[model samples]
Target: MAAVWQQVLAVDARYNAYRTSNFPQFRTQYIRRRSQLLRENAKGGFDPLLRRQYLKLRSQLLAQRYGPLSEQSSFRAYSNSIRSSRTTLDRMEDFDDDLRAQGARGHRRSVSRGSYQLQAQMNRATYEDKSPGSVVPTSVAEASRAMAGDTTLSENYAFAGMCHIFDQHVDKEVPKVQFANDDKNRLACCSLDGTVSIFQLVPTPPAVLRVLRGHSRGVTDFAWSISNDVIVTTSLDATMRIWATEDGKCIREIPDPDCSEVLCCTFQPMNNNLTVVGNSRQNVHVMNISTGKKVKGGSSKLTGHVLSLSFDSPGRILWAGDDRGSIFSFIFDMATGKLTKAKRLVVSEGSSITSISARSWISREARDPSLLVNACVNKLLLYRVVDNEGTLQLKRTFEIQQNSSPVHSIFCPLMSFRQGACVVTGSEDMCVYFFDVERATKAIVNKLQGHSAAVLDVSFNCDESLLASSDARGMVIIWRREQK
Candidate 1:
């Protein structure tokens, strides 16, 4: 019996010792290739410039081998792609109610601020929300039929939900909310508090990542740089400050002591290094971002205060909407990088122009028309850019429920629909309306309602999958489609 036990113990000991001894060898063998690759990458012996050239050559070779898609096929593919990729992703609205309550209690009681951790509790709101005027389907088949029903704007869009009020941070209204074209997850809002706040969206409710504070007065207008790295903002403080979004630091500040206020700002389409800004006065200053000074021969003038501006990338024109409902077109010279006055068209006699959104070049120049949408007082007028002469002809007029956002308020003048299929703007009646410009009649599609007060500004994210709208009362709501 003792010999039998000794034999079993000896066998077990041998098995354990062998397993332990071979483990490191097994791991080394499995990870040897990965270790070699890491060492090679870390050695810094490879030339990045040569690698880039090699990549370019490899891409050219691949393109030559595969060839380019036919023009017709490319157009068809792009148009179909605009329908949006199918996404099972849904939004959970009011996801932070419980979190807000818990945070309130923590603030009142004795506990760490960490006790207010609200992220884990929040959730996405499911189901499609029909807007106030949208037709609601009766059944599943009806819903399908409704979705396939019309080119009408309402059927295409549904209100996803509202944004969690970060009103605790500031008392002023949020005028402009521009989504970073480069980063879909980020939203930048210019407030009257003299601070530009950037919010990160992703996990249910959005979290305020950083508050870019620099302007002594209110930040009226701002935009994401073409590269999406910097945020450019114009303020009543008489300065246009560019902020690095990643670190929340002001990279450059262009001040105009010669003028009272820098009211509007936009990055040049061809030359992003050049920033085109319109002041409260007659002058429009185009500055060099690198040196933080106005570019030589870049300064131009308008008869009235420049209320809003848009860039025509294809035509190389800068379009400015003045206070008296006049459209001013400035020829942007690529060679000299200067803006020279092209033409001016006055649309309304006394109505003040609030906002202007420029449309891209017509793909099928004969079939498709390039439009410049301008909002004056409560009416939105669509003008077609006729020719190289920068001649604009009146096309369509849309009547919104009179916008009440302050005339100087960035939100008041223009409804934002830069990278989307339809034109969207809010009315004083607290309704969001979408106009289908593709339609011959410019048919009204949807009248979305969620805000209780007048909505100030509306902006769509890169893919137009998500929309963020600000109101005159300092509330912001983000909407997503029920389904992809």
Candidate 2:
């Protein structure tokens, strides 16, 4: 009985192994048979013969209990077979004309038989039996010409209506002009035309109401009071003009005895009454805007031409950039009227300072304030200013652009309508680009292009809703963001 049981177990083990091997062979044979049928169907272009065979196979397999086919597998096989058959049909249809032409030529030659007659027949056949779709030079050129013509159609369609015409021409080759927006009531623009224009910002079909003209020569820079009531303009005419924003009348024009051309000017944000003007001779003069009198003992002299100037927080410190790419900070004692020179910040080689501004709401690790300066050679430099016992020092420097056109002017505001701190830069290439300085690497996120000439100035409205850009051709373009 024990021998018999062992024998029975041995036979059962052999049977199981055979079944395992046979199952794989059965699967392999089934796949091979299906593949052959699909290839035949493809070659036949899914004709009635192939379709009938496919439907019969599907029905039979589904009816079998051990078909071992999933719904996904069946669908995949059907889709692949259909795609292959369609492709084969397309190919055959494409070459049908060529096959027909070759067959016709063969029939003509088979009917044509000695030396002279055979030679003549061969020559005639060679002349008449030319290959179809012959490579004619004219046809090839025509095809190439057709392709080239289509390439330009896309660009012409894209820029179909990108042109406009306007009126009025201001012709003074302004380097850059600063714009100020105050309380949505007053709009001030300082131009190299040696004039400051203050217009009322009205709601209905906005337009310039008045033009404030006081300077003798081209006005190089200007700034507006926080209350939007007054405007200060510095010009190449060796004077800084203070004007009333409400009217086009000039309140006072303070003449600079030492420097002839005032390169830049700005009002102290904290002290709305004080204005600082920098000249080509590297000198800064602080004046009482209300009285048109220079602040007593407030003149300070440096080395290079002062290109731009800005005031730090509290109006106690001033940051000035020069044509030599050197930045200096000065401490202003409002009561004592003393100007003490501070540290000079170094910048990139071959770069000259173009514009400067101090952040308002955004503060860094420094105790005093952070300064943002734009250079002529396409870079935005960020410096951390530390106030150590009244002496301002440069703490850090962040380089913005690596290889871009030299920036002609820059404007940095405390807050932007879109998001974080924003800096707008006008370049010599007649374009304006915006930058986000708070983020690392300080990437340029947006650009405005419309100026026919080099962009001379760029500024944002107080609310950051409107952007104004002026070019060398005396064109002023105001752009507003598209509302979402």
TM for candidate 2 is 0.58
Q: 274-359 in candidate 2: lDDT tens per residue?
A: 78888888888887776777787788886688888877645667878787767777888867545678767767554677777665
Q: Point out the worst 10-residue segment of candidate 2 by lDDT.
A: 153-162
| Highest-lDDT candidate | 1
The 0-to-1 C-alpha lDDT of every candidate, in the order given, reads 0.57, 0.53
Model 1's alpha-carbon lDDT is 0.57
Off by over 4 Å in 2: 1-169, 175-182, 348-350, 361-368, 388-420, 438-442
Work out the TM-score per prediction.
0.64, 0.58
**Largest TM-score belongs to which candidate?**
1
Q: How much does each candidate deviate from the true structure in C-alpha RMSD?
A: 21.9, 30.9
Candidate 2 at residue 2, lDDT?
19
Candidate 1: where is the Cα deviation over 4 Å? 1-154, 163-171, 360-369, 403-421, 438-442
Per residue, candidate 1 scores C-alpha lDDT tens digits across 1-484 of 2112222222222222223365633322222222223334534555656545544564455346555444323322222222111110000112122335556788443323322221222111111122211112212222123223333234346555554554532457676787775245778888877888888887757788898998999888897765567789999989889898889999888787455788788887655677888888868888887888887888877777777878753437778876666778888887777778888887776555667666531111111234445455576666666655466777666777664353221111111212124567766778777775545564566666887677777877654567777766667777775442
